[model samples]
Every structure is written in C-alpha cells, then in structure tokens.
Target: MTTMTAPAQRFREFRMPDVGEGLTEAEILKWYVAVGDTVTDGQVICEVETAKAAVELPIPYDGVVSEIRFGEGTTVDVGTPIIVVDAGGDGAAGSADSGGSAGSAGVAASEPPAVQTPAPEAPPAEPKRQAVLVGYGVAPSATTRRPRKQAAPDVPAPDVPTADVPTAAVPAQAAELNGHDRAAAVDRPLAKPPVRKLAKELGIDLATVVPTGPNGVVTREDIRAAAAPPAALPPVTAAPEPLAATAGARETRIPIKGVRKATAQAMVTSAFTAPHVTEFVTFDITRTMKLVQELKEDRAFTGVRVGPLLLVAKALLVALKRHPEANAAWDEAAQEIVHKSYVNLGIAAATPRGLIVPNIKDAHDKTLPELAAALGELVATARDGKTSPAAMQGGTVTITNVGVFGVDTGTPILNPGESAILAFGAIKLQPWVHKGKVKPRQVTTLALSFDHRLVDGELGSRVLADVAAILEQPKRLLTWG
Candidate 1:
C-alpha cells in the first residue's frame, strides 16, 4: 500500500542582530512590512533604537513573510527573532498548496519556538547567517507576538490629531473596542498629520485645496505656491514694519525650557555680541542636481540618500580646506580667534522645539554618501527631540537650509561659536541668461554671513564665490578634492 507523505519545507526567522554597540535592548520604531508580505533577503524590514541612535534592520531570509513578531515601539533585545519567514518554502503562506505549513524551523507539536525576550539570556541558536538592516552583524531566534495593551482604566489618552491617523490605524475591529471615536485629529480641509503640522507652522489652513503628492499629500512646493501664488494682485507700495507690531490685547504663552529655550538664549547672545556682516551670491546649480540624480541610482548610495544639500555641504568643507580662517570661532574672553583645523559641519534644522544646529563630527573626513547618512540620522533625531547636547557643539561652520521653505534667500544670523554660516535658497526653474541666451534653468540664491571682526569682504566674498563655483561646476568637487 502506498503511504501519503508530507512536502519538505523550510522556515526562517530574523532576530535582532549584534549592532556592536554593546546595547542590551532596542526600541522598534517602525516596521516597513507586515506578516504575509513577500520580501527578499536584505530588504529593510524594521528600524530599531540603540542608545546612540535608531537604525534600520534588514531581513535575513528570502521568502514569503509569515509572521511579524514585534509591533511598532516595542523594545527588543539582541538575539531575539523579530520576524519569521518561510524561506525556500512555496510562495503561499500556510496554504494547502504551500507544503502544508510545516517547514524545517516550523514549531514542533512538542516544543514551540520561543518568542523574543529581553530577559533570561539563553545562548542564541539561530539559522544560517544573514545580514542585518543597518550594516550590523548576524542574528537568529524565533518570534512570538505579544498581546495588545489595554490603556489603564483612569488615565485619559491624549487626543490624537486627525491628520496623524492613517488608514492603517483604523483596524477592521476598532468598532468592537469600546466606542472609541475616530474623529479626525485635524479639522482642516484635508491633509496628513505631517502636512497639518507644516501648515500650522506656516500658519496655513487645509481649506486651500492644492495637492502636491498622491492622495493629497502637500509637498514643500505646494506650501510655497500657496504663500505666493502666481497671477495674483499687484505689489503693494507700502512695506510692513520690521518684525511686525506685537499684539496688545491678545495674550500667548510658551514655556521656556528644553531645546527652544537653549536656542533662544544662544541666538540672543550671538546676535548682540558678534559683529555680523552678510553677503549674497546666487548660482545656477543645474549640473549639481544632475549629479545627485546619478548618485541616487548607484547601489552603494541606495540606502543612503544623496540630495542637493549634501553637495552644498561638500562645497563648504572644500572651501574651508582652502581657507582655514573661515572655520574659526570668536573668542571674547581670550581676545583671540580660535581657528579649528577640523570641520564639524553643522546643519541648522528647525524642529518643533525650534532651531537646533547639530553637527557631524569630523565631517570633512567622511565621504559624500557617509555625510548624507549622518545628515539623515541627525535630522530625524532632531525632529523626534532625541538629539543630545554633545551633538550640538564643537561646530566650526554652519549651513541653514532656508530653501526648504522655498525662500529665495535671507540674511541669516550667525550661529553661536561659528564665524561663517551659508544659506542655500530655493531651487526653481527660472529665466537665466545662459550662454548669452535667456533660458529656463534650475536656479537658486546663496547667502553667506561672517563675523566682520574677523572676515573682511575679500575673504567672505572668496568663500561664497568658491561655493557658487562648485555648484556651477559639480565635477570640480572631485578635481578639487
């Protein structure tokens, strides 16, 4: 008699790998894929947080994702499997056609695979080695999903902004969970949570329906266009008073603490104490933008973002190399200029907490892609209010990205402790006298400010001109480097 036999199967589980930072646990900040989703080996599946910063975690196996062992914001430890995959198994998950759900690592009827744990440090027994997401090492462990939490009986849950809640949050079973209301966090016309935050900062309302991205996601372009729409009324003859008049009747209060408070005091001291002189130099950076497009396609820079700002940064570091005096700090007590040989390039990022100029340490030593990755992590940390005090110090030069708001250009104040600050304005298609002919080109205005006590017009002008020249000829960065 012929006996029925089962099909061969293999299961893969991705554990939290050794980040090499001697970290005990990490917070799962984001999950890119869900269970039952198809993923290849090395695709970024989740982001975890160590003590230093958060990092993306990659999948170790190539197969149909069967189980996502952890949810967002869950803290996991090393050697714990965060995901389970049916590697080398058929495409379908647990289907009758996909080998009947029993893989090599499949949980046996006697001893099931243990879920991820931070305690009881058992030696990790894992499957074959695979890559971790953020250039980390190997990991192996099974996964178990934890039960949902019931918000304690008394404490009230803060009102979640309507703009913040996505379709993903509205589960099919929200109705069964105690009459919880899904009223939009924002009453504006229609916008995402982030978009609503942007509008609020710029003092805009969503009722002005102009969409930039898919599903009405407003882009920076949309915001700028809204502020200064074309085909509008004629220019006003009279200009408003500087800084505008303060409101006498209405009262507003904001707490003086945290990063905002620190930034405020420093700006006040720097503006009053430092004798600042600012200059402007516009450039046509069509070539630099083209280079950025090419770099984005390169595999080495795949996970690392390469943007226009990165090139601008490179230009600054290069200029500083040529002229070291530009990378000095004004010394009041010492009565001497403190020149720094190393450039800790600081990028002033405006977060909800206000302006914080966190810098990249030894920025001049790193390659372009490495700089881009550092910048990405720095900005993300600043926005989340996780940036520490140490990262904000020891900066020799600063770059404030006013162009992000589509601002043409502005004479920005000097950041405390820095002698020179460069301002990169908006990039737009504008009529330019190119090759002695009027043609549309991606153009922008660049502004440079320096401490007049140290830098004369010749030095400041040279620094600004050098930056503009590189943007005009991006290939110069390679030759010059």
Candidate 2:
C-alpha cells in the first residue's frame, strides 16, 4: 500500500530586541501584522516605545504569522519571544486533499510534534540564532525577578464569641471587611507596573481601590476615581443635577511616563548636581535682525530657514570656539575637567511629547547655510516625534529659545553633563541708546548659565560678552568666526 506523508513544519520565533542603550523593557505601541498574514524580511512589523524614544522593529525573515504573544500596549521584557512564524509548512490545500486514511495518519504524525513543542520551556539542545535588525539585538540573558519578602506569620485572633461565624471562615470575613478576598489580602495586588506607579503617585492604596478591568485587574481610571473626593449632595429643595456633569470635572491626572518622565528626572539631576551661575546681558540685536532679513532673501540660503535662532546658534558656536573651556563636562567620578575641542550645539525643541534637545554635530565646522539647514532638519524631526536617542547624546553646549514664547529673559538650567546653556529672550522694538542717541531698536536679553565648577565668573562673563558682541555687530561673525 502507498502511504501519503506530510512535510515537517518549521517555526521561527522573534524576540523583543533592546532598541535603546540597555533598555530592559518596551511598551508595544502597535502591531502591523496579525496571525495568518504573510510578512517578508525587513518589513516593519511593530513599533515600541522605550524610555528614550519610539522605535519601529522590522521582521528579519519571511513567513506567515502563526501567533503574537503579546497584545498592543503591553510592556514586554527584552529577549522574550513576541511572535511566532510558520516558515516551512504545507499549504492548507495539502490538508484538504488528504483522504480519510491520510488524514488519520497526518493527525498521528502531528501528536509527536505537539508533544515536542513544550521543549521550549526547557533548554534547547542547540541554540538557534537568526538575523536581527541593525543597531539592536536580542539580549541572551532572561529577566530575573527579585525574591518576594516572606510574609509575617498570621497571629491568632483573640478569643471572641461569634455564634453565626464559623472559626474557619473568620479570616475570610476579616479580608472582606478590608475590601479584598482572603487570597488577595495576603498576596500583592493585581495591577500592571504603570498602574502601580500611578497609584503610588496619587497616594491611593491599591487594596482599597475597586478594580474595574479585565480579569479583576486595577486600572489607571480606577485609581483616579478612588482619589477623587466624594461629591457633596444637593439639598432636597434644590433641583437635581445630572451625574455625568460633575464626574471628573475638577481635576485630571496625567500618568507621567515616556519623554516627560525622562525629562523631569534629567532636570532634577542637573539642578541639584551642578552649581549653576547665570549671567544676563541685554543688548541691541538690531544688526542681527537686519542680517536675518538679508539672509532670508539671499540666494545661498534659499529653501533653508533663516531666523534669529539660527544666528543665535551661530553666535553660540563662535563663542564656544573662543572659549573652549565652556564647551566641556565635569567628570565627577574621575574628579577632573574634560574639555571638548568640537562643539555639538544642542537646540532645545519643545514638542507635544515634551522638551527634547537634539544637537547639531560639529556645529563649529559648519558654515552659516549648513548650520541653518541642520537646524531646520532637527526642528522638523523633533516635531514629528522621530528623533532617535543617538541624536540627543554627547552634546557639549545647549541653547533654549524662550523668546519663541514671547517671554523676556529668564535663567535657564544647564543640561546634564554639559557645561553651559544659553537662553535667548524675546526681540522687541524697545527704546535703546544706540550710537549715543535714544531710538527704537530691536533688542533682546541673553542669559548664560554655566557650571561654576568648570567655568568661573570671569570665564562665564567672557563667553556671554562674546555672544552679545557678535549679535550687536553682526560683522564680527566674519572676523571672529
């Protein structure tokens, strides 16, 4: 008798990659493919947001998706298998074409494969490796959890006469009084890490807040609702009010995570660690303003943005070149001052996500046109939320343009690891004495904040003076630069 045998199926698994520098976990922002859908190599299959930035992950092999291990919005640890693909399997037509006897044989053959699939739970005989995307790789080690603290032994309840309650059910009754089941009262609450963080921030006890999520999980909305104060009841003589009108109308709680959370932590670190010394200079930038208008019409600057911030950036670069010590970092561990020869000028751009500073590498080497082009591209990329983590690293100096918000000068904080940050204020037509006469001139204030450890008062003043002088003359850029 001739026998029909089915081809063996080969499955490939894709793991969550470390997209950022040593980031342990990422929240799956989206998935582009589903089970039974065909995908090709190097096709973007998902986007994940790490603490540093949002990154898209691409599949490295071609196959039909067999399973997605995690759903969207779920935070997964790196090196965890996220998806499975069927790479070498017979088409569905092969199963259909098999007769009754062949089908029985195929079922018998599938049993052994199903039994072996659990082998993944144990170590494989041979480590299987596959190609991954550029700039990121799957970590080899698995995530290890810390051992839980041992709970205190339950103390025997004092003797109390209870006719109705059985002694065996007393502990369960006490748990119910505390707004939890007997098991839940003894174990940790069922909530995600993010939800737990929110609860801690709002000072709401997870055990007290009633869960309103799938599988009896605690959610952010539940935490917020618990924190919200009970509404005062209306008097019986007054007209009744709608329930929806007063709910959640007083305040809103935004869960701090992602870019905003990172920015807050960085600012706090910079503020406490660095001994900041800020110096202010109010000067007539009329000449620089005139140069801006001229550059806008210049053919060399066509298709590039020409603005005051661009000139301010160029001025800062020239100042850094003159005072190279200002472009440096303080190595606390080594107890030394590290000076930088090249300037990576950081422009602080505020987006919907939060404030981000992406720098122009080697800004001192670029000409006016090139610097303007780089500035335009940096601003555009940050606005679109596509700035990579690498672009924001290794900045020597920074500039924050508070003038864009129509505010005058204010002291700016130094970015962590950088020596100085310059804040540009609003340029308004103010009455100023120019050429020994009072006249309405385009004027602005400049605040230079520097690390006192690396830059003393004399050095910081000189750097600020040079930037102010360049903006005042607008021709010193050629002489000094």
**Which predicted model would earn the best TM-score?**
2
**Cα deviation of 94, candidate 1, in Å:** 53
Q: Which lDDT tens digits does candidate 1 get at residues 233-344?
A: 2222122332145556353334344345657777898899888899998778999999999999988787876889999999988988888887888788989988888999
CA error at residue 446 for candidate 1, angstroms: 0.7
Looking at candidate 2, the ten consecutive residues that score lowest on lDDT are: 143-152
Q: Please give, for residues 1-481, the per-residue lDDT of candidate 2 as tens digits.
A: 5344444445667788877665667778889999999988788899887666777888876789988989998878666578877876543345546666566456656676752333424432333454443433542222221111111124223332322222322322432333344434335456666678889999899989887765366877688778776552222212324433567655433556677887898899999999999999999999999999999999999999999999999988888888888888999999999998999899999988788888999999999999999999999999987888888889999999999999999888988999999999999999999889999999999999999999999999999999999999989999999
Residue 364, model 1, lDDT: 90
TM-scores of the models, in the order given: 0.50, 0.70
Number of colliding residue pairs in each model: 6, 0
Clash pairs detected, candidate 1: 58-133, 161-185, 162-184, 162-185, 162-186, 163-193
- Candidate 1: residue 153 Cα off by (Å): 34
lDDT of 2 at 427: 95
Please give the lDDT score at residue 127 for candidate 2: 30
